[model samples]
Target chain A: AQSVTQLDSHVSVSEGTPVLLRCNYSSSYSPSLFWYVQHPNKGLQLLLKYTSAATLVKGINGFEAEFKKSETSFHLTKPSAHMSDAAEYFCVATKGRDDKIIFGKGTRLHILP
Target chain B: SQTIHQWPATLVQPVGSPLSLECTVEGTSNPNLYWYRQAAGRGLQLLFYSVGIGQISSEVPQNLSASRPQDRQFILSSKKLLLSDSGFYLCAWSASRDSPLHFGNGTRLTVT
Candidate 1:
């Protein structure tokens, strides 16, 4: 089964500081990984996705994630945090192109002003 | 551009009431539709998915059911509402299994 685990349930960072949200995935086959963000009472928005392409994937709102096969990790990162970036982040994994996707318990990001 | 719309952004209903939540996608054809429920800490739970009209696949056995009446329409229904059913329901669609999903704003259902 393909699954994703978010390391932190909540993360707090000062404005303009770098942010990191760790995620680890387990899959039997080549996986397609994704990062999604959801605001309060809102639907999820896809931040980025990683197929078999480049390990480093850039996304909207200055977010990025690197797929590490050896580490079984796909950690989301930002060079600096903004108040608008505060939201719930989720890590998702799928076995292949045509497979059911599994979501991780979210990581709520708090930006301290 | 593809857009997904879900009706009744927020709903409050008494227990045992019949429930119906509708979703539709525009600017796309033969898209894959999905229904998901989000609880406080359980993450996004996929309830059902449809590959085409009249084809629905359930991922979890629950009091809820889904139907795809049209190529771009997905409806979630329940004969009787339960308190446990109170959660955020989201509708989503994707061009294919490999494509990223586009989600509707979600409906906040509160069963009283």
Candidate 2:
């Protein structure tokens, strides 16, 4: 079975500080990984996706994630945090089986102003 | 420039009432549609997906049923609502299997 684990349920960071949210995935096949952000009652928006092209994937809002194949980890990072960056982040993986995707429990990011 | 739309942004219904949530896609053709329910602070649980009109696949066994009456319209229906059914319902669409999904603003359903 394919699944994603988010290391932190909640992460607090000060404005202008670096932010890191850790995620680990387990898959039997070549996986397609993605990061999504949901703001309050709004729907989820795709951040970035890793389709085995590049190890370092860049996304919107000065956010990026590194795919560590050796460690089976895809951790999201940002050089600086803004108040607008506060949202719920989810790590997702798709194994191309039954056209289904696995979603993480999500990490709530809080930016302290 | 495709967009997905889900109606009834917020709904409050009494128990045992029939529930219907409508979703439609525009600017896309023959897209795959999906319906998902999110519990409080939990990940999304996929309820149903449709590849095309009249083709619906269920991911989880539940009291709800889905129908794709048109190429770009998908509807989720429950004959009798339960309190457990109260959650945020999201509608999403993808161009294909390899494409990322685009979600609409979800409908917050509260079955009181």
Candidate 3:
């Protein structure tokens, strides 16, 4: 089974400071990984995805994630945090194309102004 | 551009009431549709998925059911509402197995 685990349930960071949301995945084979963000009472938006094409994947809103095979990690990062970045983040994993996706519990981000 | 739309952004219903939530995708054909539920402060749970019209696959056993009446249309239904069914329901679609999912705004169902 493919699954993702978010290390933190909540993360607080000051404005303009760097942000990190850690995630580790377990899969029997090479997997596709994704990061999604959801605002209060809204649907999830895809931030970025990794499909063995590149280890470093850039996404919208100045977000990025690096996939490390050895570490079994795909951690999301941002150079600077903004108030609007305060939202719930989820890590997702799938075995391959056309496979069922599994989601992590989620990490709630709080940007301190 | 592809877009998914879910109806009844927010719904409040009494217990034992019938429920129906509809979703449709535009600018896409033969898309893979999915129904997911998110309880307060929890991860999403996949309820059902459909690869084509009249084909539905359930991921869990629950009071809810799903139907795909058209290529880009998916519906979530329940004969009777339960308090446990109160949650955020999301509709999503993917172009293919490798493509990322695009989600609708979601429906907030509150069962009273």
**Fraction of native A-B contacts kept, per candidate:** 0.62, 0.51, 0.73
Kindly list the per-residue Cα lDDT of model 2 for residues B3-111, writing each as its tens digit: 8999899999999999999999999999989999999988899899888999999999988999999999999999999999999999999876656789999999999
Best by DockQ: 3
Worst 10 residues of 2 chain A by lDDT: A94-103
Q: In candidate 1 chain B, where is summed lDDT lowest over 10 consecutive residues?
A: B94-103
How much is A33 displaced in model 1, in angstroms?
0.8
User: What are the per-residue Cα lDDT tens digits for candidate 1 across A1-113?
Assistant: 67789999999999999999999998766688889999999999999999878999999999999999999999999999999999999998875446887889999999999
Better of 1 and 2 by TM-score: 1
Docking class of 1: medium
Q: Model 2 over residues A1-113: C-alpha lDDT tens digits?
A: 77799999999999999999999998766688889999998999999989899999999988999999888999999999999999999998875635477789999999999
Report lDDT (Cα) of residue A97, candidate 1. Answer: 47
Please give the lDDT score at residue B66 for candidate 3: 97
lDDT of 1 by residue, B50-111 (tens): 99999999999999999998999999999999999999999999888877888999999999
In angstroms, give how far residue B20 of model 1 lies from its true place.
0.6
Show the colliding residue pairs in model 3. A98-B97
Clashes of each: 0, 0, 1
Q: Score the docking of each candidate (DockQ).
A: 0.71, 0.63, 0.75
The alpha-carbon deviation from the true structure for residue A89 of candidate 2, after best TM-score superposition, in angstroms, is 0.5
* Model 3 residue B72 CA deviation in Å: 0.7
**1 or 2, greater by DockQ:** 1
